[model samples]
Target: MENNTFPLYFNLTMFLNLGSFRYPTFVLCFLLYVFIVSANAVIIMVITREKNLHEPMYLFIVCLCLNSIYGSTGFFTRFLRDLLSDSHLISRWACFTQVYVIYTYASYELTILGIMAYDRYVAVCQPLHYHSRISLRVVYRLVALAVIYPAFSVFTCVYLSARLPLCGNEIPKVFCANWPIVKLSCVPTGLNNLVGMLVSTTTVFLPLLFVLYTYLRIVLVCRKKSSEYKSRVIQSCLPHIVTFVNYSITVFCDVSLSRINVEELNPFLGVILSLEFVVIPPILNPLVYGLKLPKIRKVVFKMLSCLKRCH
Candidate 1:
């Protein structure tokens, strides 16, 4: 592999075995991905558009949806491109762009979860201060963190990952992944892997730990409050818990395996990973937001009514 060669046509990734039904699978993926992305986008639109859905929880959800929009677009659109063309020889720039985009979305997700926990903590620990403290200005700052913080983290990872000389031309997974890209280094990948490990832990585990501690405090407070407050507490926690778990599995599986047995890689496993990150969460997002918050459901109905009236 030459330093400047972006092997577009020669890139044979075994991870995507386009067997007998390749077209069908691609078509299926495109349709399904479109539906899920559109569904979440609509939810975000409705939440933002509807007047009554303008609470702090809905606002945080809007942020989460914005993150999903980034993730879904980054992976789903790229997946289609890879399906259509030979994605083997990713150019240095394209590879770097992929790293930057994926990291940005991933970091936004981590920050979103942390913000959600902090939102809950404020709501629980200081019930009276919930409205005053968690205001529009505060939401803006959190959203800013969700976007900018990830950029910094991903910048560090991509900067480091790009410096390593790739060992070979082929990348195991469909698109460029952080660890997968790190594994391509010609030099000993220990340093890259060490940084990768630290980044992963700092981004994923640390926020999750804070979420846990926050929720523990929340539970204690809820227990002391009225039973009526218990359902409210549960409602706030459940959707974000689902988000946390959805993200945890993807990150865990991605980092857990160091060297992909490229020869033995299952295409379906690729499907599972892609879907977990792209499809499942988007599909679940609306349902989780709708079920967790009555205001969202009410807004949905109101939107439907307005549409019916217009028709």
Candidate 2:
């Protein structure tokens, strides 16, 4: 076949691993998808239903939970389908669409975390001015920035990749990703590489740096306070810190996986690494916030109690 001709569909090679265990894997994955959806939906519902939980912090948690559901749906619907079917081929349009959704989900996660860090910084460092600084207007603007910036940046990257004339159609992973598609291009992809790096830096690293800086300032502020004040700070900040660190590590594993030769690694390990970002954060985010934050914990327990009594 000539390198100029592009295939209509791309084969996702990773599904080959399910050889004898396809049915069991499919059932397990389906249950996981259900759990991710149910957990995140409950968080969103609790936040929106309770008037007392309508603060900026909880609002951002709602956004985070929403993104988890969004991202999980994008991956799981296709993943579950592939696990059951013999064919793992995805159409070019669908492939690009998955890339867009998953990438934007990742970008939104980082941006929201960064915003949460700033919210904490203001609440802890400037208690008297926290309400004025993180007002409803500011929260709306922050949410807007988190949405708009990542959408634009990731759209550009996906747009560039979709325009390329691919020489091959095999994607080694379970999902369609921008980089693997770019690797199949018959022509040089200098422009794609440059833009991918640029987008990654702006969307990923910049937010990471901002989050780190905010936490540093937060730590410094805590140093001057008494034990009681420090205790409160730890209680409030612990969940965000845990969430951020967990997400950062998973993202690092994913980014590192992209650069390395996945073919050389153990197939099970490679698949696990590839699945980390999509699987871990969605499940963990709700658990962390729902358990660690007293307000959310109280509301969740109350809702559960009501359900128990109804039965």
* Backbone clash count for every predicted candidate, in the order shown: 2, 0
Which residue window of length 10 is worst by lDDT in model 1? 3-12
Q: Pick by lDDT: which candidate is best? A: 2
Candidate 2: C-alpha lDDT:
0.92
Candidate 2 has its poorest 10 consecutive residues by lDDT at 1-10
Over 1-311, each residue of candidate 1 has an lDDT whose tens digit, in order, gives 56533333224364455766668877988897777777678789888888877877788888788777777787777677667664346666776787688777777777788888999899879989998899989998888877776677778888887777765666666667667666656678777767767876777778878888988888788778887788877776788888778777776666554355645656777546544655666667777887667777777777789999999
RMSD for each model, in Å, please? 2.7, 1.3
- Candidate 1, TM-score vs. the true structure? 0.88
Off by over 4 Å in 1: 1-12, 189-191, 258-267, 305-311
| lDDT against the true structure, each candidate | 0.73, 0.92
Candidate 2's error at 158, in angstroms? 0.8
Segments of candidate 2 deviating more than 4 angstroms: 1-4
- Model 2 misses residue 143 by how many Å? 0.4
Candidate 1: Cα lDDT at 293 = 73
